[model samples]
Target: MVITKTLDTFDSTKKLAGHSFTSGWLLNSLRENDKLYSQLFGNRLVKDITAFDVSGGKGFLSIVLRCTVFFVDSVNDTDDVYTTILKIPGFDSFKNDFLTDQLRTIFTEFHKSECDFYNILAPILDGPTPTVFKTVEWILDESEGCIHMEDLTMRGRTMTYFETVNLAQIKCLIQHLAHMHKNILCSDTKIWKEKHLKSSTGFIEVLDMMNESVEVLLKKCDFEGKSLK
Candidate 1:
């Protein structure tokens, strides 16, 4: 994965902030999720692992990390390197105390929803999503939740902030959206029944949050009259 561009350079050898555990902890976590790990890497012995926090300023709800695992198969006398992305809760690093306190429940729900999506829906739908390695649902007391998946950057390109997207790109995105929607509808409806109801109830709250955010932006901007309105 391309880690040098937007992500800051981090020391992979040392334990970093935002994470309570080291590379060893990660390996153990993977082992604990034996079924998934076996499906992906089989019986390869993981010798060493290096991790870098790539979240930088881009992530608001979660911290993103890129990890490289070096595996050795003694029987086969072969070694291989595997790279993946690890995402964990970002609430610890979030500086807005007022907002954090007010929206903690909402954030927790969102995180759990995402974890479930990756674990359940992602595999069933033919969407352009990363390949999942592991997903830990948010725990109440422990506050431990994470999503480990493939780093698409290895094969994909990121668009710049002000880059103009052409018609062809827009069409491609629309096509992907359509495919995802079709898969969702075609899949077992029971999986999404509760989510559809939940989302409907939360829609007004989301709109209120958006309106408040816009008001704050309007107060900050120097635009006058019609432009400001």
Candidate 2:
């Protein structure tokens, strides 16, 4: 089950599942170095943060949260609550498993790749994407990485596990991918190829584990008799 609670409920000294989710961490994750964000949150700091787990049956790569922020001073009605999507690397389900180390490495690398893309390529790419307010790669510690992005709950929708994409949507996605690939190709191809290649031998080493996961999922779906195309 998912839980939603304020940061005050968690003890500052205690480590939460080998990770820290303190208010200080939240503040740091939400902190943006942009001029506009600075001006918007000028002189006002996060009074409290309430995180709601929204990652059920979504993806196993990371933890997804809908975080609501309350400022110290509620000068206006709009200052009451601010919301953003908070994503942290690591899966709670695999915390105690033997796969924890391998999964952590994979997830952390994926998270860092995303952070790098947004930090380096998104500006030049010609595709519409969510605004990333803040993104950090895993540094010395696993808890040091996070992503605070625009809340697109109202503006967009997500597909279910068994849902199939329609032709139009697929075409649109292909068009966007084509545009992005064109932009990338026009730039330094060698740099991008060397840095972002994912088909290396090390990457494929985890394919067996991934296939095992998919088999388990397929068994569950078969039990439910859900037709997947």
Candidate 3:
């Protein structure tokens, strides 16, 4: 995996936003986008994380979520904080590459899959779209290629995940993703039975699994080679 601090490591206002980080390791989690926001908002005791910035995609977009209110009560200041979600292009060499676009498309498909697998993970993954709390009142910034949700606090309310990583917690996270897949993606309830549907279904599924552009290019190349003979 080319995963690195090159993603969320340092703030480059020079590049996009004038942000800086003391350590690169701190950004490893943020490189994936959603993980960074989850860490920030999921912590109940955390009032804030300073120098907590994200930027380093093709476009240098940035935003910070405040964890706590500085004053006792200021509706004007509001109970919410700021967080940023970024829109980035993956390729640098070409305007866009077939494999890179395929990966992005795969993420979108994964996001849909999350809704399908939310209740049964391990065998799957969940990609969540940003959503704020209506009852609690928070802002969920789900935009571009990233999900940035904020307006989270350490106050009262039954549902809260604000702590470090643990085995049980990991399991819980997995279950959560499963639930996301089940609920959001509208899972295929009969996977075992669905297998018996039809041969064309399998073919179409395989077709969907592939990148159209790649397939087309491959066909064109095959035709040209045959023509040369």
Candidate 4:
């Protein structure tokens, strides 16, 4: 994977911003004028590219960028703007540590799982998930990759980590999950079998440890509820 440092300084940011696509080599291989590109950009010539970091707490595993592409169609005398969420795997600096090593494996699997979902599964399901424009596997490692997906925020999708959700919103969320599960189960069972389990040994161990700590806290408080098993 091509590791790019964080854009901390103005000069560094400006230098990267000047490039049409920061990963020019990968983009070139994708072929800007291909059928897929035409479908994505509507055969419009790219006028400008702007990117900004929008990483959340998962910045250690991946870098999320909000990329805006401005395009112009000379033949039709029209212009349009496309916004996409670009996800790139993080660097390998933390791969040597015990905890991080496990995370690295999980992260790699996540990229492949998403690629499979977008390329194979989503089309058949006709799901409401955001559209994936392209997926570029790393030259050095196929498992580690990057992806360009439709920006759901533009379609009124919002995310809140700790905010309370209303009953209606909760019902809608549950319905969406049910629909996805139903579609997957009704589709090919073999394809979805044991392919995308999100838990690892390290993750389960940590969860167990947290549960032990919580049990101790409850004992100290003399809680009368049923014992946490």
Q: 45-71 in candidate 4: lDDT tens per residue?
A: 455556777775557556777765554
Candidate 3 local lDDT, 1-229, one digit each (tens): 6864322222322222222221232222233434544555433222223333332232212243222212222234344443332222222222333334444444344333332332333233344333321111111223322222333333322233575577997897788777866753554656523432333233344344355655567687776335444
Report residue 86 deviation for candidate 2 (angstroms): 1.7
lDDT of model 4 at position 138: 44
Model 2 C-alpha lDDT versus the unseen true structure: 0.66
Write down the worst ten-residue block by lDDT for model 3. 132-141
Q: Give candidate 1's error at residue 190 in angstroms.
A: 1.5
Best by TM-score: 2
Model 2 agreement with the true structure over 85-129: per-residue lDDT tens digits: 777776555535436465557656777788878877887795788
**lDDT, each prediction:** 0.66, 0.66, 0.35, 0.58
- The residue-level lDDT of candidate 1 at 181 comes to 86
Candidates in descending TM-score order: 2, 1, 4, 3
User: Candidate 3 regions off by >4 Å?
Assistant: 1-99, 115-229
**Which clashing pairs does model 4 show?**
none
lDDT of 4 at 195: 64
Off by over 4 Å in 4: 1-41, 56-60, 72-80, 92-103, 138-144, 198-202, 205-229
